[model samples]
Target: MNKIIYIGMDVHSSNFTLCSFEPGYGMSEDKIFGQVQFKDDLIKNTAKYICNLKSQRKDIDIVCGYEAGCLGYVPYRELTRSGINCKIIAPSTMAVQKGGKKLKK
Candidate 1:
């Protein structure tokens, strides 16, 4: 199977922070990709970022995700419509791995 670029985002009304990880890139956690403003070109800008990454690493595919919040499902719907693979994870349902920092001794 092809390597997957996993993008996780921390979104807000004014802007958002994106982080990316290559599952096969060792045990390191996700790293910051960049931040983007929430504006008229949000969708276009976000898509372009992913496209740029793909351009650099043609061997990988992108799969992004973020917790649902005040903005509702509009972003999810729009991104999917634009051919981006995204998933909405609920905060309550999100969990850290057993050995992750938060759950460690």
Candidate 2:
């Protein structure tokens, strides 16, 4: 069976991007599920997207990651409260290089 994962995000005021990485699938196969300008009124839509992914991929773990931004942790808290696993990534620590780059351990 093919397993799928969900990466929910509450982006900065500028833009939002969602990247989904499937196990056994290479980086080239990583899919950008969504990318668009952020809208404070769309919080409900964001929550719904996460919930839908959770429902569709019961066999796979739903791990979420979003850059730490001015929005704070309200979205993360909401996701966790709904039983989804999540992490707030430090954008400053994300490596920009491909090879020989080590991410935070």
Candidate 3:
């Protein structure tokens, strides 16, 4: 059986950027999925996208991370309810340097 892991997502009010990483498969190492834009509200669109990605990748474990922002907890709730594991990260967590901008401790 082929095992795939890790999915990174960059989300905004208008669109979502997705990148999938697989350890064992060379073919999936550099694969880039198309970006999806949502015309509806952020919460609804995020829920829809999570559901769709879960359905599409049933065999693989799907882990998603998005920056913590004004969108609130709706996205996290929706993703969890849809059975996709997600983490709400601070923008600073993705910073290249150790001390760029600090979020409240």
Candidate 4:
């Protein structure tokens, strides 16, 4: 069976927090895969974790996105080379909650 897992990443200078969501009939269910910490190879470590996730599952496709800023296109290139679809989002255009909800820590 083919399944799609939506992944959102919170990226910082030295670490990245990766979370995964599965589409539900009435709502969306989510899981925190984990955080990747790196001193010099942030994108490489992140891509390794993503590939690890893919290898652990069968027939599941991943679509990952991160805000466009300091990181730039490095992430897009590495993730795409690993065969995962990636999106670099503009922070100004991303949707947010009406109330104070923490999207990233």
Candidate with best TM-score: 4
Estimate candidate 2's alpha-carbon lDDT, on a 0 to 1 scale.
Answer: 0.64
lDDT of 1 by residue, 12-40 (tens): 77676677766535677545554454454
Using lDDT as the yardstick, the better of models 3 and 4 is 4
1-105: candidate 3 lDDT, tens digit per residue = 534445566666666655555564555445445455555665566567656766786786666777788666767887787677888887766646476664321
Question: What TM-score would every model get versus the actual structure?
Answer: 0.73, 0.63, 0.61, 0.75
Global lDDT for candidate 3? 0.63
Error of 4 at 67 (Å): 0.6
lDDT for model 4 comes to 0.76
Q: Which TM-score value belongs to model 3?
A: 0.61
Candidate 2 local lDDT, 1-105, one digit each (tens): 646565646476554545555554665565555444445544555656667766776776667788787878876787677776778888787766678554532
Error of 1 at 94 (Å): 1.9
Best by lDDT: 4
Relative to the true structure, how large is the alpha-carbon lDDT of every model?
0.71, 0.64, 0.63, 0.76
37-68 in candidate 4: lDDT tens per residue? 55667788778877888899888888889888
